[model samples]
Target: MFNELLKERLLDAHLEFFRKDKKKFLIHRILYAVIVAMLYAMVIMVIKMPIWLIGFPAAFFIGWKFAYLKLLSTKKNIDIKNSFLFPQFLQSFIALLPSSGNVYQTLKATLNYTPDPLDKELIKLIQKIENGNDRNAYLAFADYIGSSEAYMVMNMIYQFSEQGVEKESIQELERYIQNLQENKVDELIQHKMNASDKFGLFPILISLFLVIGFAGVIFMHYMTNVTDALNTMPK
Candidate 1:
């Protein structure tokens, strides 16, 4: 009924932004949920009710954990947001390239204008370029960005840095970065839409759970009354 992929992202995140003991907390939640499920089953058995009845309460308890997934998506959204800064950095690098001696210098100068994550990456990039590692520096930068468009932009920069490459490469990089920016916008929009759809399903799930719980209580009461009446008549 909902996207399981989002839940996987939360597991991947490990709740880094929220807790230092994330792994322990995650372990606790999982073990606790499992314990709760088993405890509910035992309760139903003791009450002489159908074991299948455990599914409703367990589903309600565990399913609301989708909320935990929603919180972790915040970290993922922030990561996707950092993707936008790459095009901005590309634009700056292209603009500074004309007066700069090489890609190393352009990357160094861009550091003055860059922000977090990208700025941090550029610092590493500049170090690698200074160490006489040109190709892999750009490659590592692209890998850090982790997208097809990112690899394309890094390749454009690699070409633009060559001694005899055409000046037209600058314009090409500019147009490509523009398109990349537009695509990133679309991606962010789609991401939010998917989250919205997931959130909308929760209310319906909650209502269904409440109805099942009410039915369970009524069933328990009826069985209790029937047992009492039979005991009075026979004994």
Candidate 2:
């Protein structure tokens, strides 16, 4: 009975914390709320100390930073990391496939010929379209992929599905796909360069210096203010 009650409590807590967006943001929000509530209860019931109240906002800041770091780690999950490599290969495979008369056939051909982390996602798109979903569904799926290049390519495909397919349209689509792939590669390279900048350590060191310097200045000012207020008191 006790275990069942604990499980229910945990589930309720999870539902309260859960969000459709980044789970990290939800986690951080929940953590900050819980911490603030606990702190409030403690102040009312246990320690009525002033010093503890000052730490409340700091708790939120720390929780948010930790949540962001956690979200970054999740973004590097196996499927997402594989997505970074799969797009080029998938594009190449799609180019090599024999000309299919319809865009849907072309997608099916690509799915059959290419195997990648994106394959499952593509298959789902195909199923959705087959099940009579509108062209925009595929576009939305591409958007969910969170790749601008993919979105562009998918948007073009959506346009083809709207207008009757033609050889010229297919050629244009191919050209656009190649261009998008190139842009993806360029973006990947830029990301790597940005990552390399992290190894320089300058940003981290400067941030630490600023934080320590600010804290010291605040402490000194606080002491000076307290001293002045005490002196102004009539002897």
* Best of the candidates, lDDT: 1
For every candidate, C-alpha RMSD to the true structure in Å = 7.8, 10.5
Query: Which digits, one per residue and each the tens of the lDDT, describe model 2 over residues 1-235?
Result: 2343324333333333333354655666678667755666577557666667667766555554444444344544633654465465446535743566666777787776555566776787888889774867777667546666667767767776668666686687677667766866887799889978987788899999999999999999999999999999999
TM-score of 2: 0.52
How far residue 119's Cα lies from its native spot in candidate 1, in Å, is 2.2
For model 1, the superposed segments whose C-alpha errors exceed 4 Å read 1-82, 95-102, 164-167
Query: Which residue pairs collide in model 1, if any?
Result: none
CA lDDT of each candidate?
0.74, 0.64
